[model samples]
Target: MMFASIASVALERAQMTRALLLRMIQMAEMRDPEETGPHVNRVGSYSIEIFEKWGMKHGLSEEEIDKKRDILRMAAMLHDVGKVAVSDKILKKRGQLTEEEYETMKRHTVRGARLFLDKASDFGEMVSEMNHYHSDFDAMAAQVALNHHEKWNGRGYPGHVDIATGSPLKDYAVPDYPHKALGKKEEEIPLVGRIVALADVYDALSTKRSYKEAWDEAKVLDLIGKEAGSHFDPELVEIFFSCLPVLRSIQQRYKEPEMPSE
Candidate 1:
């Protein structure tokens, strides 16, 4: 009886921590109108769906996958949290950015990664105090933030830095650090990062943004299919298509407000 009571309290506290983290993500992204909606929620949901369908093929047991699902959902939200640091001029620009502006924009990936890594110990302690649950997910979340921009072919950025190595740097704004290109191939990227990458791209392509109308769902899927080996994990792409119905249902449920015709 005492054990049950302790377990219940732990679960409640964990829930609270998750809620707080998600709210933080929303607040961080509120600067950009395009990101202020259900974008984070949809990406998290889409990642959950993808993992549910394909996690086992990656060698995780059903129980392990189930345990990690919530963590995956929450961590996915922070994938773009570094955008908070980007300038409004760039983030809200309706036109394409100049080369310099685009380069600056990519710094968000590294910035977001640093947000978690820098605070990992503190975050772990807080979660432990709140829920008495020991979770390594803070580190995992940092990895997802760092690597979500990485491509299967290794072309993505802020490119190929081994973020697992701790840094003494305190200023998150300055991205000038020695980040070596480790030359990671498809399987080398963390599985969670790969999953969120696909979800992020899918949501971005299928939804209307300030610069463009939403592409037709068929076109989006076709592009994702075509980019399988180079842009995405081919096996995960198959899993994505195999679970099309659920993905569509998720899309409809989180349907963005329609843009007025120009």
Candidate 2:
């Protein structure tokens, strides 16, 4: 084969490897809804919303943005792949979990990283970074997935405080020391995790759980808006709301149509 053709084959192989890793996570989660529920679908959709916003805000080249969009879509799908490791007892808890049970449930991030690392060693860095720090936005996207629960006024989890004091990642902290004054740059965080956080929380709140009634989209958006400064990035939250019309279209297209009124 020509040299260019050989290189193309190699690149395709790598892409296939990454794709297979994602598929494994999805298939496993699908078999057990209690573990991830309909979360993957919601994450996929929300991540696209965030990325599209980011692309527009940054004015990225179409080709570059498209690549980023693809990665965000795949990343969103695998965000909670760690749940597959949790025991069914915890994963399927119908009511509020005991403190210990909740703590155990939280370990899915570490578990998920291990799962991805074992299968797709090439993307180990991305998977591990996302699993451990997707919620940690104090430093940027690096911290979002790990620290998404963090509040602007403080009172989040894991660290419980903002990265203002200092991010756990020395590298991220070095760039912005004494983090308190770090004006929110909503663009710096991982678009994939930010979007997933919104989707995960919205679906979790909206879907009827054993303990609580599901809230509709408008109610969920209201809550999200109320918490924008503390719980979410205001700009991104605005983008989320702006995209609601499109989101409704997505739901209408993919979700089963309601049965005719009888």
Candidate 3:
């Protein structure tokens, strides 16, 4: 009876954690049509596929992959959760944004990161103890949220910020960059960050959004290939094409729900 009871509680906790991911996605979807549940789901799915391949190539054990996958899945879904705080005009704008508007949109990274800091307490110690990661879920969720936009060439926003303040860690700030956080290049970007960076761009290109229609597979593949070492980490870019079959499966599995004929 005790074993059954413990299993039941564990299941409930798992459901609640998923519920939280849905709730946050719903909030962002309300503001930006492009930030749909399907989009986040796809990003999360792509992130894991990329991560799994990277882990294997780097010789990480199955146990390490399993544990990190759990956190990476949840964190990838919340990567854009900070968009909840961005102005609707920016997110919903149907056309190109002016420089000022673009800067405002970039703040979402730090804003999303700020949401996760110190949030583990709300989920309780049991959640942490069960996971057994060195840092709590909040830390990784915050990292992905802050680093997804970062480029392998070191031009991503919200780089090196004070996690608590969301203020640019000015010590490393680039000269005259309005948003202040310095670009995180190469290994300076976190692993999860690099994984999601590729995942996010893939989804953005593969899906139809307010800004543009989805690119065909060949075009999309070509662009990602060209971006290797510049926009994306070269190693991850290689891992991505290697697991192309699985990643393609995830894209279809989580593709956007179709609209009814008007």
In order, candidate lDDTs are 0.78, 0.56, 0.83
Q: Give the alpha carbon lDDT tens digit for every residue of 1-262 in model 3.
A: 9999988977777777667766777887887788888888889888998898889989999998998887888889889888888877788888899999998898888888877665455544434544334245678888899899999998777677877776667587667864477788899999999999999999899889877999999999999999999999999999999989988888878878888899
Report the C-alpha lDDT of model 2 over 137-191, residue by residue, as the tens digit: 1122233334443344443433322322233333333234443222223444344
Q: Is candidate 2 or candidate 3 better by TM-score?
A: 3
Model 3 regions lying over 4 Å from their true place: 1-11, 119-135, 176-179
TM-score of every prediction relative to native: 0.84, 0.69, 0.89
Which candidate would rank higher by lDDT, 2 or 3? 3
lDDT (Cα, tens digit) per residue for candidate 1, span 1-262: 9999988988888778877787768677787677745788888899988988887666878888888887888888778887887999999888989999997787777777776666455655566566313255676777788778878987666555545442223332224543334334688788888989999999999988878888999999999999899888888899999988988898888887766899
Put the candidates in lDDT order, highest first.
3, 1, 2
